[model samples]
Target: MANSLHDTYLTGLKNAHALEAQAIQLLSRQLERIENYPDHAMMIRTHLAESEAQQKRLEAILERHGTSHSMLKDFMTSLSGNLAALAHAPMQDEILKNTFANYAFEHFEIAAYRSLIALAEEAGDSQAIPLLRESLAEEEKTAEMIGAVIEKTTLEYARREAAGQTAGI
Candidate 1:
């Protein structure tokens, strides 16, 4: 039973690692398109670096357990994130859409880290708790930042629309 619990915990870490990699790709694409919104672009760029560091931390955790991340899952998630970002590229409210998606994704990551922390505790993996907690805190902060900006982005979109600065459709 303990072995099974450890395996589950490892799986959770791998999933979180893959999701962070996907976030890197997602944020990179969004950053490229958010040139119109310098604040948003800078925040995304900063988070992209954070995501990379988080991935490294996850790799360290998995290495200590004698396992590694799932390459196939990472590839699939990265592709999906990139595609999702592109889907909003031509839309008039691309910034708003990206902000909403980013907020949701950050929350998803926070939940994953929280679950991983619980699993680590159950498995008596004291070494993993701090690492997981760090990532969880970062995810929560990013989610809060995105949430705080949503209203501003929405208002900016309205202003742009009124001024005929946005795309027609």
Candidate 2:
């Protein structure tokens, strides 16, 4: 993930395509979670909407090079759907499985966007650089907001669970 675009400009473009293919899966999972989990729907609405747009953006990036419409896209989308469905599972984990999933996913997305942006800049793809940068901005904001939510809810959930256990005891 060092993103060394040293050799050819096409190397950078290929890297970006790979990132898009990856993102398409991640976003699909998030979207499905938004649809299935009524509890998180409102809270994650903004991010979901942005993610929808992000799907389009990523696809456009791939389509720019005619690489978006590939088998990789379908595979990634299926994988992401499976993963996203798990987001709404019972609050089994101490931190809330969904919250952990969201955080881990956002972090992954942030890295993907960062890589794409760096490669876009390095390759001198002026159009792509701005588009990638814009997506990166949204990804950053989404990650920051999700991080805040996780921080706020984590301790509260832990304390409540602890209190419930004590009462039961």
Candidate 3:
């Protein structure tokens, strides 16, 4: 039973790691095409860097537990994120779509980290708590930031539409 609980905790950490990698890919794709929304692009670029750091933290945690990330899962998730971003790239509502998607993704990450923290506590992995909490804070901050961006983007889009200008680049 102890071994099974530990295994579950490690699996959760691995999934979080893969999700962060997927976030990086998604942000990268959106950043490339967010020329019209400089603020939004900047926020995503910053979060991209944070996501990379969070991935490293997860790697360290997994290594401490004598496990490693699932490379296959990471690759598949990254590919899926890129494809999803690409699908919205050429659309007139790309900004709106991407902003909404980012907001949703951040919440997903927050939930994953929250679950990992709970799992770590159950497994008596005290050392993992601080790292998981730090990542959780970052995810929460990004989610809040994205929420603001969504509001700003919506207003800006409305204004542009009213002026007969394209709302997306």
Candidate 4:
């Protein structure tokens, strides 16, 4: 049972690592397209840095366990992230669409991290607990930040659209 739990913890760590890779791709793509929303861009930039750090932390945890992240998983997830961002690129309401998608993405990460934390606790991984919790807190904070601006973002886009301006960043 203990061995099974340890395996599960490692799998969770790998999934979290891949998730961070996807996040980096998504945030970088969004940052490049954000011309009208400096505030939103700044927020993405901040979280991008945090996501990179979180990836490194996950790598360290995996290393301590005598393994590393799945290269295939990382590659596939990153590709999907890029594709998801591309899907939003051509929309007239790109900013609004991205805002909604990002909020959902943040919540997804929050749920994943919470599950990872639980796995870590069950696996008796005291060392990994702190790192997992740190990532979890960051996810929660980012989610809250995104949630706070949803209405304002929608309104900004509407105002721009109504004024005959390019509002989709």
* Highest-scoring model, TM-score: 4
Clashing pairs in 1: none
Query: Tens digits of per-residue lDDT for model 4 on 140-160?
Result: 999999999999999999999
Q: Report lDDT (Cα) of residue 157, candidate 1.
A: 78
Q: lDDT tens string, model 2, 1-169? A: 3334434344544444444445445444544533323434454666666665765766676567555444564566556546554545443442356666666767877787777677667666677777777777887887777677775566656665676642100
Ranking by TM-score: 4, 3, 1, 2
Candidates, ranked, lDDT: 4, 3, 1, 2
> Which regions of candidate 3 deviate over 4 angstroms?
none
Per-candidate clashes come to 0, 0, 0, 0
Compared with the true structure, all predictions reach lDDT values of 0.87, 0.58, 0.90, 0.93
Name the TM-score of candidate 2.
Answer: 0.66
Model 4 off-target regions past 4 Å? none
Instruction: Decide which is better by TM-score, 2 or 3.
Output: 3
> Lowest lDDT 10-mer window, candidate 2?
1-10
lDDT digits (tens) for residues 4-50 of candidate 1: 99999999989998898799989988877676687788788888988
lDDT of 4: 0.93
Worst 10 residues of 1 by lDDT: 160-169
Error of 1 at 139 (Å): 0.7
Greater lDDT among 1 and 3 belongs to 3
